[model samples]
Target chain A: MKTSNKSVNQEAKNSFSIKGYFLRHIQVCLASLGRICRSPVSSLMTIAVIAISLALPAGMHVLIKNIEYVTSGWDGAAQISLFIKKGTTEEKVVNLKNQIELMGQIDKTEYISPTSALEEFKRLSGFGQALDALDKNPLPAVIVISPGIEASSPQQLNQLVESLQDNPIVDHAQLDMQWVKRLYSIMDIINRGVMIVGALLALAVILITGNTIRLDIQNRHDEILITKLIGATNSFIRRPFLYTGILYGLLGGIIASVLIGLSIGLLSDSVSKLSSLYSSGFELKGLGVDGTFTLIAGSTALGFAGSWVAVGKHLGKIEPS
Target chain B: MIRFDNTTKRYSEGHEALSSISFDLNEGEMSFLTGHSGAGKSTLLKLIACIERPTRGQVVVNGVNISKLRKSKIPYLRRNIGIIFQNHQLLFDRTVFDNIALPLVIQGLPHREIGRRVRAALDKVNLLGKEKLYPVTLSGGEQQRVGIARAVVHKPPIILADEPTGNLDPELSAEIMHLFEQFNQVGVCILIASHDIDLLNKMNKRIITLQQGKIIYDGHEMAPKSYHNHENIQ
Candidate 1:
């Protein structure tokens, strides 16, 4: 009975110690955060540095996502009209339109009469007198064909053009796609550039946090010596510093998030106006929940890791002597 | 309990602070360690505390060869011994209550237990009412008392006080010595090192005096006796 009671008491003590360890960590975290709070100016300045660091990547991320959203439904290549000879009549063009529409892969077919073709040329090319001076209207009755959406890929459209070129009645096949492909490649390069910048900035953030924690450990040398002398475990002594790092990172993440949001807000009007010049009302995007969470989590993790590394190195140098 | 066998601590540039010396301090007994400034009194305390290991010797504390102990076990050993510094290294940033409660908090006592024990320790040191005051607000002697209160707050088995009253007047010094006596009466083994012969004569405890890295005397306190070529020790 006595042995059983002793073992039971031992179990209780073990459980108590476990609880004590966890609660002690909470107290340390609180104390660290409290110290930051007490020094408001320095804390804000530190947080602002973090925020700026996080903002660079976060802002780029928003811009990329917005660009993706804007260009999501755009087609790289668009079909054009193939003008027939002037001698061709409405019957000739209608015959060609009907023939093209009957094809399995053709999306749309339009037949323009000689008179309508002449009016379109005058309006589009601004050559009304030349369009009207001709005795019998020198323009051709044209047949325009747009490929099926499913068959709109570059290879498929090329095959369709080849088939069109083989037609005896058509004069030419055309496409308006030169500038679109260039724009796409430009966007791709920019997206990759943004990712590289983000990675480099993340490294800078870690270095900032590590150096800050190093200074903090130096400042608290006396406290650390006292703590070690009193039998405080290394983990116990390190907890508050780690928490301080985490706080700095989290606050910085928040600041960065806000900065990104405000930047997006400020840019939204200008971007929309610019998009309108392109006849598109594309709006700039703000950071969503995942973005906010990533900023916070990434910054916090960096803070924790930086402090851990700095504190571990510096803590070893402190001799209870 | 502590034992140092053939302990030789040599610093850089060929300075052997403590020569090949040996001694044993049994458990549950009060003793004093005294020497000149460089005679290694503090070094001996530091070695027992495991703050610094002997350069070439074995240190056994509480039946365990602590000198051979791993780095991980150092904290456990320290939790069992309380140390008071000559400068009374109290944190100026913390209140006297929080300062006294440091060791207990480090041990992770419950909040109420921390409050009760810190108050009790402060009461013992006669600094009860100044618990809320910061260390900077306290006098030199009061700060030292706060340090003493913090050292005893966790109720360690052994207490090492290095010149606990070196900076105090004789009246406060005796009062501090009486406090140590009260603690000794409660079965806490204490080792104090000091330079005040007047206080040492009045202490009336077992005294161990050191001179030039050697134990010149170890005996019950009676009266000052002239010794050949030894520094005045208290």
Candidate 2:
């Protein structure tokens, strides 16, 4: 009988301890949740800030990705113009044009005779009578050179032009490839700038979440004191807060993603119209899966990290007192 | 069981909050920690609760020196002890039933069990009918009762009450003290911190006094003669 009673008491104690274990978690979560529910205004405000901060970087990220995706194929449009001096002979110009055509780097070359250039300029400029007064045609023969895809870079074309400049017949050789290089460089710089700004804003989102969590910990100061006194471990106390952070992060991330998608959707039509106007058949595209996934993971990580930082700092000082 | 062995807690700038504090509360033994506001009574309680770490020495509770326990272990230890505060610290935002149900919920009890336990605890505090009421709507005394109900809802083996009746009238104070005594009768070791000398005189429980971060008395019923100068503690 003694042993049986003892065993029963032990079982009761075990049951009580197990019950206690489960109850603590529910208590902390409900407490934080109740606080959130009570102040819907503040909670919403915080969430909005988080979402907006997240949206800035997320939007920029999507835009950069789309721009990169659309432009990757067209980045190699290198053009070269072989300029001749005003006094160059038409026969020598033809000879040089033929030489460039036979080179492996040349795809297509068009020769403009001095007489044909003078007539074409007059016809296009609507100034045909003014050119008739000149005793000698002042125009120089030129070659419109198209560099093959293999020799698409500015350096390659520059080298080609320099080699041509050494010829006695060619007075001057100029390649109009600066525009392509300049455009590509500007786009590259802009993309990098967007990424840097995105990273900084992402950090800001995390800090915002952390600050919010810290306030939460402070608001529950009484409960925290009680919990600490009761022998609640710091991790146990921090768990629900961590969970809150993750939830905030995830919700904000989802919101940010939606916001980016909506912004893109709103602009996609206008962009397509504009692209069509430019005759490029371009559309303002949205980010693909790889980019979207990156945004989601980054946003979620920001939220989790924000809450974790807040929990870590606040929980540290919540000793029983 | 708890034992404070030469435990001393000093502030960051060397202000001593507790000095060489040593005491032991065994299984089922009830006591009261009474002193003035700065008598280190609350600090002693905080040390026991592991809310504040001891700057020096050891605080062993349930065979673990809480001073040496990792942050993760505090909650597990807290599960074994219950705490009630002067603020009644009941979340005014929630219903009384939910407040009382907190500790049990922390233990992750099923919904039905939580409902049952909350009902039982509310009944003990005589606030059964007011279970759905918010703390803000309750009287000061009723709020304290709600706090008490929350403390005992999980049936923790040890309870620490910090000025449980500091805000109540004499009649309500007696009522609250009676509730603590009843829990004590049931083998739940109770330690109350208060400056209620008149009430302490009425209850025949052990009284431990603190004066300038030092223990001046450990009387069975009232303040020891040596603790006469420490009545200013709140």
Candidate 3:
């Protein structure tokens, strides 16, 4: 009975120690955050540095996404206009349209008879009187083929045009691909630029955070030595600094999110107005929940990694000698 | 209990701090170490605390051979030994209460237990009312008292102090010695290193004197014909 009671008491003490462990970590986290709050100017400066670095890439990424959205909207109406051979009858043009429509790669195909094609051109061209003086109809029957929505890339559209050009009755296949290629190339360049800038800025964030943490370690040099002398584990000495880094990272992430949100809010109105002028339904996209979470999570991770590196390098050098 | 068997500490700079010195301090015993400025007194204490491992030989503190102990186990070993520095090493940023509560906090004690023990330690050191005051606001003696409070708060079995009263007046130094006596009465083994011959002679405890990285004198305190006999020093 005595041994059993002793074991039970020991178990209680063990549980209490476990509880204290978590409680201590929570206390350290709060204390570190409070320290940052106490030094608002310096903390804000550090956070601003981090936020700017984060926001540049994140904002550029959003811009790229919006640009892609606009381009895709423009590409939706893109079709390959295949002018049928002049000697071909309207029956051959309709049959070609039917055949193209039945093709798996074509979403839909429309056939315009020679008379209607000439008539529609005459109505819009403002050269109607001049065009009526012609002895024979100059316009050919045309088949306009829209590629499947799955063919999103310019390369895919070009391939569709190439296939349509191979039709025997087709005299010419025309696709306005210059603008599409330019848009894609521009987007590609910007995307790569964003990645390079993001990577470099990410490295900068790590170095900035690391240097700050190193300075903190130096400032708290005496405190760290005292704690170590008093049997504080290296982990205990390291905990507060880690939390400080995490706080900096989390705050920077939040600030970047806010900056991106404000910029989007500022530009969204003009962008939508311009879209209306062009009869396109494009809108600026802000960092959504996932984006905001990723920003914060990513920054916090950078902070953690930076501080981990700093502490691991410097904490071992300090001893209560 | 502390035992050193032929311990030696040689720094990376090729300077030998403590060389093949051996000593045994039993449980609950109080002693003083005396030496000149560079007599390896601090190095010996540091070795026992596991702050610096000995270059050669073994250190067994409280039945554990700590010379071979892993770096990961150093903190656990130090938790059983409380050390006081000459400078007190109190953090100026925190209040005396937090300073005194450091050891217990390091142990991850509950806040209530930490509060109870910190107050108890402060009461013992006669600095109970100054808990809210920062270390910089305290006098030399009071700062040393705060260091003592921190050292004892965790109730470790062995206490080591390195020139703890180095900055205090004779009166305050005696008072600090009185405090150590009070702790020694409760069976806390203590080893204090000091250069003050007057205080060492007055305490009448065992004296272990070091000279140039070696133990030259390790015996009971012997009183001279006159307590002020300067010629009989060392």
Candidate 4:
């Protein structure tokens, strides 16, 4: 009997010390979730505000990513144009093209003879009759060298152009990098703007969650007092509120993901049409798995932080007086 | 199990709620604190529960000098104490069982254990079948009995009640006092604050009467029950 009693005591102690902690947390977590569900209208209103706040920034980020994707295909336009010297032999032009192609920075080199260059220019410039007036072609044989994607930055392109200009057979080498630089600068500005807006919206989410929790604490004033009187620790009283905040954050993140998906679906057709008109195959991209996960995790953390602040500020003010 | 040594509690408003009050109630002892309204009965009980700190001297419970206890340690101290209020502060939103199980839940007891103990406490208070009912639906006396069940559910060593029978009729008040007596029989020290002279006379327990923040009487020996009744009438 003594041995059995001792074992029973040990079992009780172990259960209370280890499993009891997790049990209490799980109970509170579910209880807070149930409380939110009991008041669906109010809970949804809070969640909707949080979702819109999260969706605005998340949508802008996805838009920026898609814009970057579309612009990446235009990188080939920043090619370097090398004008061969007049009276250069065809064999020498061919040799120059072979040498430029062998260089790692040059992706491909196209050799345009003077005859084809003049013909293309006449066709594009609408000066065929005038060009026919001249006996010899005045256009130089040109070699358009497209740089490798890795070497397409403005500085890399400038360096490649300068080195080609040093060639004795090249008259002038030009790179149309102005537009590329302008596009990158615009993207940078927009990215910075998105960051600022995201930060402001995140703060809004925190404030909204905090205010909701504060009202909840007020509504449960007597409950808190009675709980405190019965010997509840500050952490014990704060657990349910913290769980409530986290639930709000989690639901908000899920709704934001859905909203982003809906908006993407709505705009995808228009985006594809516009791209097809531009003769490009760009498609709108939605928030992928990683993005959704990050959004939910981030919003949950924000919720925890918001409730931490509110609980810290309010729970202490309530005593058993 | 509880002691007070020249304890004084002065509010910030310059009113002394308890002054130089001293008493000792041993383990398994049951006592009554009686006086007119605002005569320091509630304040004395609050000091024992550490809800209000004594402005001077020591207030001790279970051998701990609660006057010097840390804020974080107060909860642990209170876990060994059960307090019932005059208003029977029950959460109307929860069922009677949930209300009674609160202290055990705070202590992180197992679910099955909490249910067993809550029912046992309810049985003790004769409120066993009303576990699922909300407090608002219960009568005033029944509600106070639920409060009593909640206080003793955790089986704390000390039980302090401040006018727990204030709203109950004479019969219901006797039933509540009988529950306190039953708890005292099991080695729980009890201190009930009230001004019910007739009830106190019938209990014949130690009665500590306070007048204007000072103890005027502190024993069961009475100078003629009629004289005490006359004093109350005056």
Candidate 5:
């Protein structure tokens, strides 16, 4: 019984010690934040620099995402026009349409008989008198096919066209490759450009944070020395500075998120007007909860890394002697 | 408790700070280290705190031979020893309460316990009512008392001071010495480095006098009261 009681008391001490450890960390972080708050001008300056650097990449990423969304809608508008042989029966054209619709890459197909094609072309082509002069109908039966949304890339659509042309009834399958190729290349270039810019801007954030933390260390040289003399461990001496760096990161991240959101909101009005003009149902999306979390997490990580580098280099040079 | 075995410290600039100095301080003993300026007094105290290692010999503090101790363990070792500086070294940015709470905070004591101990230490230094005032607002003696309060707040077994009362008046310095005596009465080993010879003789404790980086004297009764006890005359 005595031994059990002693063991339980030791266990209680261990738990309380762990609790105390975490509680101290919380206190230090709050104290560091309070310290930053006391110096509003410099802290605001650092936070602003960090926010701008982070916002650049984050804004670019969101812009690229919006572009992808708009372009994907354009992809849905792309179509393959299948022209049938001049004498192909309406029954055979409809059969081909049914077969094309069954293809995994094809979304749906529309069959237009020769008479209907002639009527539509004559009515819209401003050549009704010329078309009436012909004794026989010359327009070919056609099938219009839209590729599945998932397989609507230029390569996939071209492959589907090639396969359709092999059908006995299909005389030729045609789509505008020039614009599709241009659109895809543009998207590729923009994606790569955004990636490069994002990476460079992220590097800028780290350097900014690192320089800020370095200055903070210099400012607190006396306090650090005194703390060290009082037997504060290196980590204890390091805690507040690290918290300062993290605060810079966290605040920067939050501001960047807000900047992105505001830019999206500001641009959304113009975008809605333009999309309405083109009768597109597309809407712009800002960085959602996930992106906000990722931004904050990523910048916080960068802040931690930057401070670690600065403190590891500078803290060793300070001695109580 | 401290022991220095043939310790010699030489700076990289070729100045020898201490030369083969040997001494042992027992647990609960209170002593004074005295010399002129640049007598290696601060250097000696620094060695005991493991702030500077000897160029040659071993230093043992509280049964730990810190000469072989790793750098990572230095803070843990320092927790067993408290040091007071001549300049008081109180952070002017924080209140006296926060300054005194530093060591306890470093030790990660619970908030309630830290408050209790910091108040107790303040009471000991007779500065309990001035806890919230910044060090810059306090007088020189008050600042030194805040330093002393911080040093003893953690309740380490050993305390070291380097001219702790160097900037204070005679009355305040005597009061500080009396506070040291009270702590010594409770078995806190204290080693103080001071240049005040009159005060040292009045205390009647063991005195280790250094001259030119060497221990010239290490006897208990070398003060004027025992000048006749030494028969050897040059």
Candidate 6:
């Protein structure tokens, strides 16, 4: 009976201490935040530095996403144009177009009669007077085949063009793939460049936070010394500085998001106008929900890491003496 | 309780601050450590507090050999022993109440318990109603009292003071000594380092004197006159 009573009392004390632990942490967290709020000028300066550093990479990321979005439709533009033999009958050309459209890899096929092809050439090439002086229509009936998305890869497109060129009625089949490959290469390089810049800026953010926290430690040297003398644990002395770091990072992330949002808002109208001028329905994409969340989470983690390093390096040097 | 077994401290600059010093302070024993400024009174207190470790000997506190205590364990050791400084190391940016509440905060005491204990300590130091005032606004005596309140707020079993009354007037210094006597009466072991000959003579407690990093004397009221004469020669 005595042992059971003592066990119950021990449980009560444990629960009480657990509650006290959380209470103390909450107090320290708020006190750190209050310290930042009290010194608005210096705190804002540090936060602004973090926000700008974060914004550069985040802004580049948004630009790349928008660029990818704008160019996404060009994948379907890898069409194969088949020039038919000059004397092929129009009926045979139509039949050939129908046959190609039924192929598994073909999206759709358009047949252009020799007459209409000549007229389109004259209108587009500004050579109507020169064409009128010719004795006869020298143009050939053409069939344009758009490959399905699954078959639009460079190798598949090459295979389709080669197969079409072997047909008796087709004089030549062409697929303009060089420009597409160049576009992809450019995109890959830009993506890699953005990644490098992002990594460097992240390092810069960490260094900035670390330097700010170092200054904070120096400023509170006396407080830290006194607290240590009074039996405050190193963790207790470190708590406020860590919290200050996290708050700086959190606030910086939030402001960077806002900055990105405002810039996207400013650029939206001009981007829409440009796309409309090109007769395309493409729209610019901003940092969506996932991107914003990742930015905030990453910045907060970096802030924690920076302050952790600073605290470990500087807090131990402050002995009670 | 603190026991020093032939403790010696040497700095990296080839200065020996303390050499072959040995002493034993019992539980609930109040004693004064008196010496000239450079005679290593502060250094001895620092060794007991684990702020500095001995270069050569064993310094034991509460039966733990703190001369070789790990760095991570220093804070726990300090929590069991309260230390007061001559400079009255109160945080000037905080209120008197916050300064006194720091030790309890470090111990993770509940909010209500902290308030209750802080008020109790403040009452002891006769600063009951000045909790909201900042330390910078207080008089020197009041500030020193706040430091004392902070040191004892967590109720450690042992207290070590280094020149705690150095900045006070003679009357205020006596009052502080009286406060230490009251704490000692309640079974708290205390060792104070001071060079005030008159104050040490009046306290009527065990006194230990150091000179050139060596104990020249240790006794009660019997050695006051002789100690005074020695100081006059120095």
Q: Write the per-residue lDDT of candidate 1 for residues B103-191, one digit (tens) a residue.
A: 88777788999999999998999998999999998898999999999999998879999999988998889889888888888889899
* Candidate 6 or 4, higher lDDT: 4
lDDT by residue (A136-254, candidate 6, tens digit) is 99988888888887686677888889888988999999886677777778998999999999999888888888889999999999988888877666778899999988988999998
Q: Candidate 4 on A196-227: residue-level lDDT in tens?
A: 99999999999999999999999998999898
Residue B145's lDDT within candidate 6 is: 95
Model 5, span A75-166: residue lDDT tens: 86678899998877777888888877877767777888888989999999999999999999988888888777887787788788788889
Please give each candidate's TM-score. 0.82, 0.70, 0.87, 0.89, 0.87, 0.86
- Candidate 6 TM-score over all chains jointly: 0.86
lDDT, candidate 3, B159-232, per-residue tens: 99999889999999999999999999999999999878888888999988887898777777553333224335
What TM-score number comes out for model 5?
Answer: 0.87
Instruction: Please report the candidate that would top lDDT against the real structure.
Output: 4
Q: Clashing pairs in model 1?
A: none
Model 4, TM vs. native? 0.89
Docking quality level of the chain pair in candidate 6:
acceptable
Query: What value does the lDDT take at residue A315 in candidate 2?
Result: 80
Top-TM-score candidate index: 4
Give residue B23's error in model 3 in angstroms.
Answer: 1.4
Interface root mean square deviation per prediction: 6.9, 7.8, 7.5, 8.1, 8.6, 8.3
Strongest candidate by DockQ: 3
Regions of candidate 5 where Cα sits further than 4 Å from its true position: A1-16, A81-94, A104-144, A162-175, B223-234
Clashes of 5: 0
Off by over 4 Å in 3: A1-18, A82-93, A102-108, A112-142, A148-150, A155-176, B223-234
Query: Clashes in model 6: which pairs?
Result: none
lDDT tens readout by residue for model 1, A1-321: 234334333433453466677787788888999999998998788789878988988888888888767764464236657767656666766887888888877768777777787787789999888757677776666777776666755567677777777777677777655555666678879988988888888888888888889998999999989989998778778888899999899889988998998898888888888999999867787889988998899999988888888888898898787
